[model samples]
Target: MAHFVPRASFSLPGSIPKTYFLGHHHSGANAIKGILNTINLVIECRDVRLPLSTQNPKLESLVAGRQRLIVYTKSDLCTDSPAATHTLRGLYGADNVLFWDKHRPGTTGALLRKLKNSARAIDALTGLRIIVVGMPNVGKSTLLNALRSAASPEKKAKAAKTGDQAGVTRKVGTSVRIVDSEEKGGVSGGIYLLDTPGIFQPYVEDGETMIKVALAHGIKKGLIADEILVDYLLYRMNHWNPGLYSRYCEPTNDVNEFLTAVAKRDGKLKAGGAANWQEAAARVLSLWRIGKFGRYVLDDLSDEAIRAHQHLLVNPHLSQNQAKKLQREERRRARTGD
Candidate 1:
């Protein structure tokens, strides 16, 4: 865990490379600017498992003062209970926050109904132009397709590209009309969805956050070595859900030895009967990524951590100890409702 910490926090020193952005500025600028120009509503999508880490606060600043809605995608992959909804609402704010599982067929209708109900102020003649933004592999494209599917049953082709891997939607700010007046058989039916590439902050300030983003597949793979990611995942699984992991393999803190054991058990082998540790590492990561280890929240969204993060964001020059004090005071105020 200690050895992997540096890779996770590399962004803290402004060392994040171009590969992370992957030409989002050049290719996706049109969509972002278009959103700025024509967007009536901003739908910010996030992975349910890592709501806080995957959020791009910088994007929020860009679209500040707009009618923004936070929709947590990939809800099916999360293991959180019903109460988790309330937790998210409390952290993000009360209205216009929603949970969605794209795999569910009726999700689009439900989302549209929610949107219509929320946007009562907007006249029926006015169409809804929404831009979906999030980190990579958080299902922005899938959500768009779902909306397209629900809006027009005759449209069979997918409106946006989608895949299990990150960076599939390299070109940002592409517009796809989801519903038109013809489909609704009236003059009042126009809904458009703008798709944007996954945009990440220039620097990620924390190691644990980077790890969580990687685990969520928000960042492109191979940016962080598989071994380092697997190591962190193993540590987290052991700490958080040891019983589920122990069912597959014996508990061990050593990443290398654990990978070897997993390789041997799964029959992943090199030429000379040695365990294929790399393959084993990949397998372990895949299971956790797909929710085999159960649901887990990567961000420590406790009031104390939230205040610490807020304080750090606002007072970047503050020392670590000073930030801690600020966090404590905020927690006290929250407890007293002050």
Candidate 2:
């Protein structure tokens, strides 16, 4: 494990041919950072989560002179696809872009094909080993699994089910090849993959807050699912399902008011006709999880905030030289009104 490095520390990881996935929270940042900060062959991975999508410009600097694959994970659910694709391409160019489904198992073949092609292209000239890095839970493990399975059939068993979460595949590897023994695309020949845990930075939270954080990053533009998520919880408290009473469950309707009605119906009333609000909301969260509320994506941050976040990611460690250069450029532009 990497020592707890301060967020602002800009020291590039030791010289290793690797890839780095950059972002705010996990999703794809933590794992990529680990590979870059420790191993060589690393380039960089961009956290395409809703919040941090276009939020970081310094991210471009991290991918300099390395093989990069723009992974659009959770593509099935995101409301904005074309815009995201365009934004990333506009910034990183179309050559590096790619997409992935978090739950799908077959996409790995497509990815490996692309990687091999890229490696072959770059290998013909310069560069070292290639590293696939990304934020946690951005399908790195799944990608590794698909790669492994694609390489070797016997070694590629279905994901182990423990309970509500995933079971670890111990046979995989400690620090060797990524997809060691598969079949056609097996790592035995050359290609490899490294899987890392989901990254949960200080800013990440579960449930509704998690959605909000993602939106704040500019990873996704606009999603009605977020309000829908909170709405479902609020709706169920009032003894109604989401979208069943669209007008009544409008965003303007007060959540606390909805809680009151829920409390009265659920016998959470106080001494008088008034109902307990907090208790009702808590119960609503439970019910919502149980399908009382429909699936929803909470895009918390607005477009304006995302713009600011993008600005900060780029200027986080602005050096004195950069600052002076920027100041000079600004002054020159101002004088010329250009």
Candidate 3:
């Protein structure tokens, strides 16, 4: 029997979109900037699975010069990449980066303590104002609700609307008090947090970044076909550890073979017992999202990848106008096959 070998590289389809910038994303950026003056601390939420891809360069510029706390949400989903946390903390500051999981109250408590400490330092009568911002579906609203629930146990209801898909919170929300005044042993004036809509970058030059973002549901659903996503996922799984999907089948580069096995095992079959590839792909994605298959970070965390990412953040390859022009050229090429 021959030993299984994964493909050295996954070819990206040109059909993948380079941007998912919606009307809400544009308005959300402007709204966040409009209120930047009133904000004391910015809570930037990012998915633990795709930390680098989830970081919006536009948001970084908007929140520049402000005290920012980088909270990696859904940390439980990337437990396999323990070094990712340490590496991120080293890049940012040990005090600036926090790994958070909604299920873990200890993590939430740690974040609450940080917020309270910041509030104490400010000692503001108007309260320490904070705004939660991040890419779509990265859990900005979810984090806000968690912090609110942790700080104020009496408030059981969620303050911001949340959903699995992107663009759930379209508009900026009113201020929700997370802590009480000094008399109540909270902060000086108390701590308040404003939840903003998730903002996507104006342009994503790398197709792989878009795919990773899509896998994390950072973009609108159906932007990229589920089959394509699962294929990319299968490639990654093979590289990480072929046994990640061993229950379905042996490691193979063919996405159909894997999806067929999944359909048979999970009962995603058509009337005539045909493998429902679409449904199977979605099932795999759902399972991965909940950390069933494996918990791992999608971004390349090697020293080189990190340095390249940092460099790109500091010096973007193209301006907004240039990006638009490049997108237009790509679309024309797609149409004419030039």
Candidate 4:
């Protein structure tokens, strides 16, 4: 007869990786910097589910002086957090933050209009050149294709290659025209966008951020085990609403029990009827990614969380060193049992 309550905190595993930075990511950053002088604007994309986690601090610094617009891609997946848009707009002025949904043409139109306005202001002889950049798998290519399609209705074929997994576009793509010139009722010189490979931060001091990024498919699949990711998902779902998973079973802290119920309901089982936890975990993740369970924002958007995030961005080195020192102290305490 007792009501269910979610845990106040989820313990992160010690094995959680602090970095997903690869060789391609480094090269991608350098490539963006190389073309900074030519780029008139930067369309920085972040997954709505993990706005903070998907932000690459290094990339931000590289393109700091340029005109930037923070587009939260997959906004449809964060409908559960209705106020998330307002909060984000408040953090980074309303004009600077945009919630974009590929499914909604209106959202794409809004972005196109903004791009055209920027192009009109510059009145470049060649064209308004923009570069799309973001963390891995945050929908940079997809956004480029969407903009191109929206601007040029007759162009049926996609200009940029898009995939759900990370590293789909390993190199910088050539410039693709998204708008026509003034005679065609478009911007002054036309609008072109360059799609760049998603670049990950050099290091992530917080393991929880790694888990969140992994859940959003920003990092390579299986970098963190599906089971571990699912556990984190379960914890977050519980905190939001146990009813989010009511279709499977009663809310419980036991990931095994939850996965077993999911396996049985969804037929993710072994030949002998035993639960296939891995497959079940994957299924859960796939469903959540598409917003079957609930459309929620994983990052904490409260005032305190925002302030901490801003502080870290301002003093990244200090935060990283402090985090390392604390990690060392934690390990030492475990060894000493004090």
Q: Top model by lDDT, which number?
A: 3
Estimate the TM-score of every prediction: 0.82, 0.50, 0.95, 0.93
**Which candidate, 1 or 3, would have the higher TM-score against the true structure?**
3
The window of 10 residues in a row where model 2 has the poorest summed lDDT is 161-170
Q: Rank the models by lDDT, top first.
A: 3, 4, 1, 2
Q: What TM-score should be assigned to candidate 4?
A: 0.93
Which of 1 and 4 is ahead in TM-score?
A: 4
Model 3, position 88: C-alpha lDDT score: 93
Tens digits of per-residue lDDT, candidate 4, 164-193, equal 899999999999989988888887889999
Give the alpha-carbon lDDT of every model.
0.70, 0.43, 0.91, 0.88
Candidate 3 off by > 4 Å: 325-338
TM-score of 3: 0.95
Q: Which runs of model 2 end up more than 4 angstroms from their true locations?
A: 1-65, 80-82, 104-106, 122-132, 158-173, 176-189, 198-211, 214-252, 257-307, 317-338
Candidate that beats the other on lDDT, 1 or 3, i.e. the better one: 3
Best of the two (1, 4) by lDDT: 4
Better of 1 and 2 by TM-score: 1
Put the candidates in TM-score order, highest first: 3, 4, 1, 2
Candidate 1: list runs displaced more than 4 Å: 1-19, 25-31, 81-83, 118-120, 124-126, 182-189, 313-338
Predicted structure with the largest TM-score when compared to the true one: 3
Q: Clashes per prediction?
A: 1, 41, 0, 0
